[model samples]
Target chain A: MPKIKYIEENGKEHVVEVPVGWSVMEGAVKNLIPGIDADCGGACACATCHVYVDPAWNAKMPPMGDMEETMLDFAQDREATSRLSCQLKVTEAMDGLVVRMPKSQH
Target chain B: MSEQIVIIGAGQAAVQAVTTLKAEGFAGSIIMVGDEAYPPYQRPPLSKAYLLGKLERERLFLKADSFYPEAHCQMLLGVSARAIDRKAMTVLLSDGSRKPYDKLLIATGTRVRQIQVPGAELPGVHYLRSIADVDRLSPEIVAGKKLAVVGGGYIGLEVAAVAQKRGLEVTVFEALDRLMARAVSPQLSAFYEQAHRAEGVQFCFKTGVEAFEGHGKVERLRAGGKLYPADLVLVGIGAIPNVELAKEAGLTCQDGIVVDRFCTSVSDPAIFAAGDCTRHHGHNGEEIRLECVQNAIDQAKHAALAMLGKPTPYREVPWFWSDQYDLKLQIAGLSRPGDQLVVRGDPATRKFAVFHLREGKVACVEAVNAAPEYIVGRKLIADGTPIAAARLADTAIPMKNIV
Candidate 1:
């Protein structure tokens, strides 16, 4: 299990252990953490699950796909570190990962 | 007396209704009755990821199994409401029990439209509506299998895409002139046809299925004076709203159970309807029945608010999306008649958007692999903002600056 930290727009923090092969958005949603709506239900079709990854943990993740990249263009306050949480699958190496939810998704 | 809300149907809208009620400080008891054995799960993945085996069964759930209990809600799974006694303010269940409610919500959703042609009862024939439907069809989606898909709508095309990707010989039959004729523009239909064709998915347009020819199971589909040998047949003509329950209860039913902007039944304020089972009047005065997750979620939100006495009108900008191979088709707003179609970006690259403008305002936008347009288009539709056609057509202009 990968321990993931999710920080919401309202300064709430949720630290939970996510099973492998589950997306970051799923980890948040399954744990009942608010702010990551995942409206398309992890299809990466909607950008509602936008999150900002801590730069230190960015390198451990896989490169963004075209669909995820295109969807990130719609996220509010997008940054180089902005990623759709639904596209980021959890792995053992991603332990201690921290993702900040965008205010727009809140 | 503090009231309990009894919701019929345990789909997306029903779950949202309960969640909204709890989130809005409603301490009343919430009872959800669903015919399906599983808790509320997302339906979009049934034809795509779930069928392809990329997603697991448990992942499809909108919330964990413990969610209902944690929310202080009671769920009557695998049991359906047999009757609604409006005067008695109670629901008769399939298990021969009655549940009383001060308020009622009908969110029974829609059922898959079955093909009435001969041999439709074959074993290999399937309809992609519920988890059980896909569970039966998933085992048949193997490599090199012949798949004959009936109907070219979203479900049909989506299943075709998944089958094609799984190395299956896929052929789609459409009664319409083009694919997705009722929902998308012709340009999109043409684009999808070309894309699917490139993926080796054959299409037979202007063709209607006469019957399914096989022995004890579907082996061939007879359509348009031709026999297509198929190992599996997936029917996706469309869905019919589950309005019979409402109608039986003497509620006003048209295309769906008629509801107002607040999602309250036009005939009875104490009874409300939401999601696919509702024919509601939008802020623009159009009576439309939408069958999308967005509508299900938002309409439930409004219905919960109204039930709590907040009474906010359900005026959400309609948006929809589809996933075919690498292309993501996103649509926002509703296209009205005589809308000027503006092309932004070239479709040759498969990253373009079609902006439908009515009365010089952005009425609707269909974006293929263009997410910015969809995001901006949804906001533009919601705000009713006008934009210059030339500016909208120019790809260089940032979508955020259009308004």
Candidate 2:
């Protein structure tokens, strides 16, 4: 199992054990996290699953693709470390990564 | 040094573009001008859950009140941008204020196409688009009165579903041969016709509404050489893009404001357009305009990238979804006029996916009450992979492996 930590806007952190193949968005949604709506259900069509990865773990994750990059641009309060959680497929190297959710999802 | 970006509409496209700009690290002054008083909100739910009083008004908001400040964008509501001075790079609002911008985005979107019948302006007739329209119509749905819905598109059908669920006598009048003639295949349309009919929704297909008969409020609809009585009428023929501002500003306008794949105005590099208001060159070299929320958000991002001088081409597959009753219809890719459709799953069970093939290539997929198929179908459409008809029609095989 791959462990992931999600920090909400108020600086509250949640640690969840996710399957290796599941995307970060899927992990949060399956665990019933407060954020990560995933309205389009991991289709990368909607930006509701937007999150900002910790800069320290940025290099550990895969680079954003065209589709993910395009969807991230529509996310609210996007930052230089912004990534669509649905696009981030979990791997062993990505364990213990931290992501921050925005205050609101448009 | 920072530049100013002014958007001419406060619709979905405008809101998405503002967010996209800030996300891309564009430190610029952003201003959104719109005729509506409120910020951009979801329009799809207005005719469904919102109309049935199942969803709250706050949940329908696209963003919170603090979103603008957090994103560092300014909104000018209840004021329309009357004209654009291209030479001076300024937008003139109706209030006689001129705002200069280094880059201008046209996301004015579209307005409901009004009926040309005699009693179109009648008191009881309405069009569903803005929150104001939904607020006025919700009480009627709750009153459990008779209703007549003109046009059989997603809007009309979704509203009819909600009205019927609310225990109203609902009758739908479609001028075309089938429901959603332009958007869905005949099989899918037939499935919906049967499903709605089963839900006590009366259908009057191939009927042209000639006039609305009433003294001050609508009482009857004259169509198909017959008069049908109604307590309220909803006219949802379609929508036409709000391109008057762009056209008046001397930008090239056809069916909509013409833009390239980059969402940049074909005639001007400084001006870009997106959303339902702009018709961009499609993959097949035809001018195409999409009205769904996906297009609004995606095209806005493309336009933002263009404004940033990134020049990212917009080539994502167009997808749309509609919810009616208990069925959720998701469609991916664009289908041509005469594409061959293959049906998978049983319409009798009210759960199936229809695949449209053009010249042995998958053109589109429409799934009704089928979630897994819609997810897999979208990926296949995006990949443009060819799948055998027999394989697609076989329900035993999971769709994920087909691609």
Candidate 3:
């Protein structure tokens, strides 16, 4: 299991151990982490699951696909490191990855 | 004294009511009655991820299992609201009990419209509606099997996409001339038809399924004046609003439970309805019923506020999306007849948008793999912004800059 940290806009942090195949959005949703709406339920159709990734862990993950890139344009506080958490699948090498949630996601 | 709010049908709107009431600091008793065994869950993935076995049962839930109890709301799962005693402000349940409520919300949603044909009751024929429906259909969705899907709507096409990806031989039959004819524009329907064709999904347009023929179970279907062999038959024609309960309770029902802009029953102030079960007079003064998650969630929120005595008219721009074989279609606004259409991007690349204009103002937008257009198009529709046809067609002008 890869341990991932999710920080909310108010600075509240939740650290959960996610299975290798599950996405970060799934982990946060399963752990009942607030502010990560995942409104479209991880279909990447809705941008409610927007997350700002820590630059250090961003490189370790796969680059944003065209679909995810197009979806981020809907996020209220989109940043360069912003990604749809649903598209980011967890792997063994991604242990201790950190991402911040936007207030808009709530 | 805390007011008790009773919500019938624990689907998307029902669950949304529970959360909204609690978040808005409504110190009231919340009672949710659902006919399903589980709490409110997301149904979109049932045909996509859950059917493909990528999603688990627990994840289908809109909220974690414990959230309901932790929120101090009472849930009556595997039960239903049989009758509404408006005078007594109580609901008769299928379990021979009554639940009293100060306010009531009817979010019964819609039910799958089954194909009324011979051999419809066969074993291998399936209709995807509830979680249980998909559960029963999962084992049959295997590779090297033949699937004959009836109806070329979003649900039918989605099942075809999943089946195609699973290496199953898939064929779709649509009575209309094109796919998603009622929901999308002709350009998109043609685009999806081609996309699915490239994925080896066969399509029979302007055809209808007359009957299903097989031994004891479904083994073939008769459609388009020909009989096609099938291991399993899936029907996704569309859905009819669940309004019998409301209609029997003496509320006005037209197509759906007739409600005002506030989601309140036109005949009763104490009663409210939302989701696919509602037909409200929209901002445009037209009675409309939308079957989408966004409408369900937003309308439920509006109903909660109305119950709080802070009534806000439900006038949010309508939006919907569909996923099929790596193609995602996002639609916004309602397209009316006589609206002029403008194509924004090249359909050849499969990343484009079609905008509907009424009286020189943006009316509706259908975007395929175009996120910027959908995001901005929604805002434009909401604002009723006017745009020049040339500017909308010019992909060089960033979407955000158009408004």
Candidate 4:
């Protein structure tokens, strides 16, 4: 199991044990987190699963692909740390990694 | 260094455009003016899950409450953009305020087209478009009351599915020969019609609503020389683009606001249009307007890139999906009326994909309860890969191997 921590917009942190193959967005959704509405499922079409990655964990995550980047352009309140959680696959190196949900998932 | 980007309507397109602007490194002041009070939300679920009490109001929201401040986007709700002063680059609001903009995006979307029949304005006669519409109709759906849906299109069929699931007697009236005739193939429509009918949904195909017979509320619908008794009636004939504001502002307007391939207004460079309101020039030299969430998001991206001067031509394939009674019908690409359809798999087994071919090229695909085929079909349509009809119809050939 891969443990992941999500820091919501309200600054509350939740630690959940997720399967390695599932995306971070799937983990949040399956856990019934407050934010992260994956409207189009795991498809890169909708940007409702946007999250701001902790700068410390940026090196551990893969670079944002063109499709993910293009999808992120549709997310509200984007930042340099912004990444679509659906595109972020959970791995062992992602333990203790923190991600903040966007204020809006529109 | 204050550049202003004003979005005319605060629906999905406006919300996505603002988000895209921020992602693309636009530090300008973004303002979204919407006539509705609520923030951007998903409308597709209104007819299905939301109406059936399967989804809460919060679940239908596109963003949380903290979205506006976090995105640095100002949302002026319950305010309509009345007019546009092209020469001064300003938008006149209904509240007697004028906002200047360096660039403007018209995402007014569309309004439900109502049937012009007698008793059309009856109290119980409704059209589903906004959240309020769904909220008003939810109780009726849950009560398992009789519902007469006056169109066999996607909206009507979806509502019928939800109503039937909620134990209501649903009767869909379609003027066309079959359900979803304009958007789907005959075989696909027949499958849906059969599925819906199996779920106790009655249909009146090739029949038009002559009138609604009721005094204070809807009591019955007169169609096909017969009166179908009903407690409630919902008219889902179609939708017309909200192009009055654009037309009054001297913009090129035909069926919708005319825009180039880049989603820029053909008559003005600073003005761009997207979503259901703008008819952009398609690859086939036809001006087409799509009313899907995919189009809204993709067109918003195109418009945002164009506004930033990093223009990308809008060439993404349009796809749409509808959920009805355990069936997830996903469509990849657009198909015209006369397009050829080839079926893969068994319709009788309730699992199949119908491929629409144009000039022997794969033009579009409609899949029923087939997610993998829909995904591959989306990629194939986007790639414009020429697939042989025989190979497409062959079940042994995997869709992944078609590429």
What is chain B's TM-score across the candidates, in the order shown? Answer: 0.98, 0.97, 0.98, 0.97
Q: For candidate 1, write residues B220-300 as lDDT tens digits.
A: 988988888999999999899999889999999998999989999998889999999999986467999998998998999
Error of 3 at B159 (Å): 0.5
Model 1's CAPRI class? Answer: medium
Tens digits of per-residue lDDT for model 2, B1-403: 6899999998878877877787788877898898987887777778876787865676565655666766668889999998899999999999999999999999989999999989988888989999899888777775468899999999999999888888999999999889999899989889999999999999988899999999889999899889999899998999999999898988999989999999999988999998899899664456798888877878999999999999888887788888887787878888888888889999998779999887777878898766556657766777667778888899998765665
For residues B1-403, what per-residue lDDT tens digits would candidate 3 score against the true structure?
7799999999989888877887788887888999999889999988888888888887788877776766668999999889999999999999999999999999999999988999999999999988999989888889999999999998999999999999999999899899998998888889999999999999999898998988899889888678899999889999999998899899999999999999999999999999999998765667899899988998999999999998999988778888887778898889986889899999999889999999888889999989889888888888888889999999889997986
Between the candidate structures 3 and 4, which one is better when assessed by DockQ? 3
Per-residue lDDT tens digits for candidate 4, residues B297-355, read 78998999999998988987788888888787788788887888889999987879999
Model 1 lDDT at residue B48: 84
* DockQ scores of all models, one per candidate: 0.67, 0.06, 0.60, 0.08
Chain A (candidate 4) TM-score to true chain A: 0.95
lDDT at position B125, candidate 4: 92
Give TM-scores for every candidate, taking all chains together and pairing residue i with residue i: 0.97, 0.83, 0.95, 0.83
**Cα RMSD over interface residues, candidate 2:** 10.1
lDDT of 3 by residue, A12-79 (tens): 99998998888889889877787787768888887889999998988888888887887787678888
Q: List residue ranges in candidate 2 displaced over 4 A.
A: A1-106, B283-285
Best by TM-score: 1
| Error at B236, model 1, angstroms | 0.6
Give candidate 4 misplaced runs (Cα > 4 Å). A1-106, B283-285
Q: Provide the overall lDDT of each model, using Cα atoms, as 2-decimal numbers.
A: 0.90, 0.84, 0.89, 0.84
How far residue B291's Cα lies from its native spot in candidate 2, in Å, is: 1.1
